[model samples]
Target chain A: MLSAEHITVRYGRLTAVEDLSFRLREGEWLMLAGPNGAGKSSLIEAAARGVPCEGTFRWQGEDLRSLKPALLARRIGFLSQKNQVTYAYTVEEVVSLGRYAYRAGLFSGRDGDGGAAVERALEMTGLTALREASMLTLSGGETQRVFLAQVFAQEPRVLVLDEPANHLDLNYQKQIFSLIRRWLDQPGRAVLSVVHDLSLARRFGTHALLMDHGKGIARGPIDEVMTPELLRRVYGMDVHGWMRELLAPW
Target chain B: MTETRTLRRERFTPLTCLALTAALLLTMILCICVGSVRVSFSDTVTALWNGAFGLPIPEGIARNIILRVRLPRVLCVALCGAALSLCGAAMQGLLRNPLAEGSTLGVSSGAALGAILAVATGFTLPGFSFGGSMVLAMIFAFGSLVMILSLAWALDRSLETGSIILIGVIFTMFSSALISLIITFASDHTRTLSFWTMGSFSGVSYPHAGALGAALFLFGGVLLRFSPELNALSFGEDNARHIGVNVRRVKLILLITVSALIGVCVSIAGTVSFVGLIMPHIARMLVGPNHRRLLPASLFSGAIFLLLADLTARTLLSPIELPIGVVTSIVGAAAFVVIFYRTRKVRR
Candidate 1:
């Protein structure tokens, strides 16, 4: 279990996320839903330790702050919204970076376990065919999948994703959702994802947190927290009927 | 996909690096052979071997030129070139900018200011007669680097590439202004300062070469060991950190190492410009951007490049040697234009 309480993230004077709290248990997917500038990314960033925040992140009754970064990275994988690799490295080489914490030295050839992890990540992301392609030359959707493969190769117990579906096409987006679903089926795994699409979140999230302008408005089971009343109050619109019609196709 | 395969085929291998090293060694021999007094190739090799083993050769001008004049100069050129090239490669990797070089961060200018101060005030250690000026130059080199790093740190922003480079360029301008101020006031030493500013390998001796070669070996080893980290950093600092690399620690180490390298090169060769800037790009064209191969290839190519430049500087006008900085600047500027055009064309 990962427990975070009263997490406040501040950038200088402006508070990006304030008085946020959430508990993520194993085998759960907690989808963060909010409008633009609603502090979802900041909250997820704080949880990932990507930014400084006033909070306690405890993993299995141990304070996460006490763990070394390498050890923490092995337990939790953080994938940011921006995933641009400026170099012309091939997909295989980029994915191999995910195994850095496990590797011994610079010249130590990738051992059996590292190679297997990279291969598994590539296969899972359906990128085995494009493994040899240069990352600089890949399409935006393919690039997103490539980075996803990189995070997957870390093989962490908890995945913190910030807008992981950005720049992905419809097919890859669906594939990403299903992949997250399959990953959550594992016994000791959890996910904290920031996503915009309500339909996809409704289909996948077991729990949800709704935020508006740096404050959490509601938090509970997915169906209860995502009611039209809360949605209209947060989004400043009555979208109940429109969402129903749009989600009807699913 | 097939294009990637072809690129892979062209990718640098150990054999390629070995061939480059061999070519460098051959070039060194040839550079030693061609000078104001042209020694034959066979005579040059024999005299160099005899000098290396401390065996006495015929007491003639050939032996004296090979051992005293050509040998030390060639070794100094090679060591300084290799050091600067490695520094350039590491700086570019650390900054994630292809244009980054030893002088880009104002280290060379800082060292130049230090050397000018030493010359003007006649700064000298009483007991230690040799290389007092060099020690001061290195101190100022390190000082300027610390200034740049601290400025970046104080900005309260993450050490993003753009911010660091911007700070570095500002520091470069600041140091260059200081150096010009120093040069403006000193009348008697103005000539010396100007000559030093324009870099040369004319008066270098064996001890200077040894010191540079040793420093390069020690620091170059450390830089090479960070190849995997560099590979990660090429993606971006955040990406590297997400993969468990301590980005701050890696950047600090690389910055310090590259600064030390630029300091030593500037102290020895008096701010030989553009070898560091252009050699790595040429090496990357031949080899891929992978540092494991790029490092060695760049080192060898840099040595070859400077040794040839020195030879040309000596022989271009048989009696009056041109300053080595002129040759390197000319070659470097032309190469930069070609590289810039090609890169832009590729992007388009």
Candidate 2:
């Protein structure tokens, strides 16, 4: 399980996330649902040590900050929303970069099971065919899958995703979520994702944490926290009704 | 799959290593033979063979020029070429920008200023002159790196690539203006100052060659070992960190290593601009972006490219001995334009 305590992110006069805290249990996919400027990404970035923030995150009773970066890497995998790659690295090579945590030294080659893990990740994400292809030639969805494969190859106990399907179509959204869902089926694994699409969060997440103006509106099982009353309170609109209306046209 | 990975990780076998050594040695001998005094290839080889074994000199050959002059200059040039190219590749990987190099980052110019100061001051003291100049150059190079990074951070927290290059241009201009001011104040130093603008290695000696060789292996080895970290970094710093690369630590170490490299090269051969920026691109074209391959490949090509450039600089004009930087700059400027255009096109 992964846990956070007194998490806060600030920028001078503005408080992005304030005194936020939550625990993500094993086998649970916790969707951090919020509208724009709701500090969802801030919290995730704070937990991943991507930005300056005040927080203490623990994985399986171990304070992640105290752990060496390489050791912590084996316990947590984070996929950023935007990746700027300037080189023409092949998909296979990019994914295999995940093996760095297991490196023996500065001059070491791939680890013992590095190849097998990369093969599985590539095959699992349906990137095996594109393994030899340059990342530049891949579509948006394919690129996301390549990054997802990289995180999977890391074989961490927890996954932290910041809008994994932000720019992708619904088909890709479903495919990527389904892949992560299938991955979560394995024991001793959990996931925490920051998502704006309430429907997708409700559809895939077993638990939900809703925020509004940097404060938690509701937290618990997905169905309870996603109730019409609380959804209206945070989103300031009838989210369920809007989703139903959109689905009616379908 | 394992087979494919192994094939990708293919390394130079002992046979290839030996072949490369022989080829490099032969090329050096050939380069030594080409000059105003035309020593035959056989004599060149014999002189080198005898020099290696500490044998007595023969009557027919100009062993003094062969052993004590052109050989050291050529060797120093080659060493500087390898070091500059290696530094270029490392800096490019560190910044994740192809345009980033000693010149573009202003590190070379800063180190150039340091070298000028050292030359002016060291004209007095003959012993440890290379050491003193290298030390000053390293300090100035690292100082310039810190200046650019801090300036970029002040201008934009994100530290975008375009802004960093802009800052580099500004820094280089400032350093040039400073050098010009120094030139005005000290007319006596104008000859050395102008000579630096168009880097020449005609004055290189055996000690200079040995110093450059030592720095090349020392700093270049650090870069070669960080191949995987550099590969992860070229993707993105956040991604590299998530993959346990210790991004900040690796970046600091790599930048310091690059500064030392540029410092030593600038001290020895002046600023050979494009070798660092273009050599890696050429190497990438030949061997993919895997830093393990690209680093070594760039070093080799850079050595060869500079050797030819030095040959052209000394011979094309004949006796005049144009500065080496002029040759590399013309080629580098063209490469820079092509690369800039290509990067923009790809983004669009």
Candidate 3:
């Protein structure tokens, strides 16, 4: 399990994430929910040790900082919102990079074959058929899937997704979410993702942590934290009623 | 149609490298024949064979032309080509930008400035052959590269490709301006320095060729070892970092290694632009983007390109001797335009 206690992120005098806390356990899909500028990303980035923050962020029992970057990479695979790939790397080549942590050394040999793990990741993301296809030729959704497969090939115990579905169409979103769902079915695995879509958080997440103005307003079971009353209070609107109102004509 | 698809799909193989090597040797022999005093191919080869093994001299043009002048110049140009191309590929891979070659990145410009300084001041580090200017060139190359990269980072945190290349160009101009200032003050050395900046291998002797060859092997091997890291970095630094590439460390090592290789080249010759810039794209088109294969492919291709370019330089107006940099710059500028648009196309 990965957990953060009273983590706060600040840029100069302005605090982006103010003492927010959350923990992710095995088999749990924890949705980090918030409206715009709610510090959801700041919290996730802070926990991932990508930003300056003050708090206790632990992986299992050890301080996450105590682990070497390469060691920590093996434990948690991060799927950032964007991966800039301008070169003509094939699908297989991109995925094999997930094994970088395993094969990295200053004078390591040229035997950089990721082999079975790369293949499995490709299969899991339904990219095996396009293994030789260049990343340049892939569509937005396929490109996203390629990146997902890359992290999956890393074989991490915990997956940290930063809006994995952003810029993706609805069907692709469902497909990506379903792939992650299946991944979580495996033993000794957990998921923590920043999600803005409340419906997705409610549907796929077993627990929810809602934030407003850099403050965690609620944290508990998905049903408890994502309730209409709390959601309206945080978002300053009738969350469920407004969504239904927009969908009525459709 | 099949040829296009085959070219698209083909991975650079060891067979391709071997074939290029053979072609490079043949071209070099043929190129050696086409100089001011045209020696026949058979005589050129005989001269090379006899000269290489220290056999008894066969008098006339064959001996002096093959052994003394043409051989060393060809070898120097070829080594410079390989080093420039390899450094270009490494820079492109590290920065993930086609525009990130030595000249555009100000590394070569800085080396040129250093060489010009050595020439103007009559400064040469003792206890080294071609050591004074080249040593200074290497130092300045590293210095300029660090300056350009830091300036780029300061301008933009994300280090967008366009912004970085812009900084490099500005720095190159700045350095060139400084070089002109030095040449203006010491007008007597103007012609030597001007022709030198245009980049010709006329000045390269056997010792310079030997030094360039040595640097090629040393720095090239160091670069080749980082191919995997370079591959990871080509995608982006964050992805590289997440996958456990010490991006900072790898960038630093690659920067120093490439700058040294380029510095050695510029000091020995002049700013031989575009051998590094244009050759990688050609090699990449044929071989794909696996740096392991691409680096060697670029090396062979660059060597061949420079040999041909040098041949054209001397033969195009035989005895007039156009600067080799002129040839590379013409091709490189056009390629830069095409790449600039293509990168824009990708953006849309």
TM-scores for candidates 1 onward, in order: 0.90, 0.96, 0.93
Candidate 3: interface RMSD equals 5.5
Clashing pairs in 2: none
What lDDT tens digits, residue by residue, belong to model 1 across residues B1-348? 433443344346567767887898899999888987888888888898887898878665488788888889999999998888888887777766676676656678788778777766778777644366667777888788778767876784555544655786787677767777777787576335545556898888988888798889888888988877887888777788888888878888887777777776777778787787798888877666777667777888888888998898889998999999889888887875676566555455
Better of 1 and 2 by DockQ: 2
Name the weakest run of 10 consecutive residues (lDDT summed) in model 2 chain A: A103-112
Q: How much is the lDDT of residue B305 in candidate 3?
A: 97
> A202-248 in candidate 2: lDDT tens per residue?
88999999988887778899999999999898889998899899999
Query: Candidate 3 on A103-168: residue-level lDDT in tens?
Result: 645665422445677778989999989988999999889999999999998889999999999999
List model 1 lDDT by residue over A1-250, tens digit each.
8888888999999998888888899888999998999999988777666789997888887988787666777888888778756556779888877887776655563444776788889998899999878887888778888888888888889988888888778887888888778877989999989999888889999999999989989988999999989999989987678887877999
Model 3, B1-348: lDDT tens digits are 422332233345567768888989998998899878989988888888877798876666468777788899999988999999999999999999877799888899998888778767878777774687888889899999999888988999877778888998888889889888888898785445555567888867888988999999999999988888899999888788777777778889999999999989998888988888899999889778888779988998899999999999998997799999899899999998998888889878
lDDT of each: 0.79, 0.86, 0.86
- What tens digits encode model 2's per-residue C-alpha lDDT throughout B221-337? 899989888899998789998988888899899989999989988888877888999999988887788897889888888887888888888788887888999999999999999
Q: Could you tell me which 10 consecutive residues in candidate 3 chain B have the lowest summed lDDT?
A: B2-11
Model 2: runs farther than 4 Å from truth? B1-4, B7-23, B121-127, B189-191
Best by DockQ: 2
DockQ of each: 0.45, 0.75, 0.49
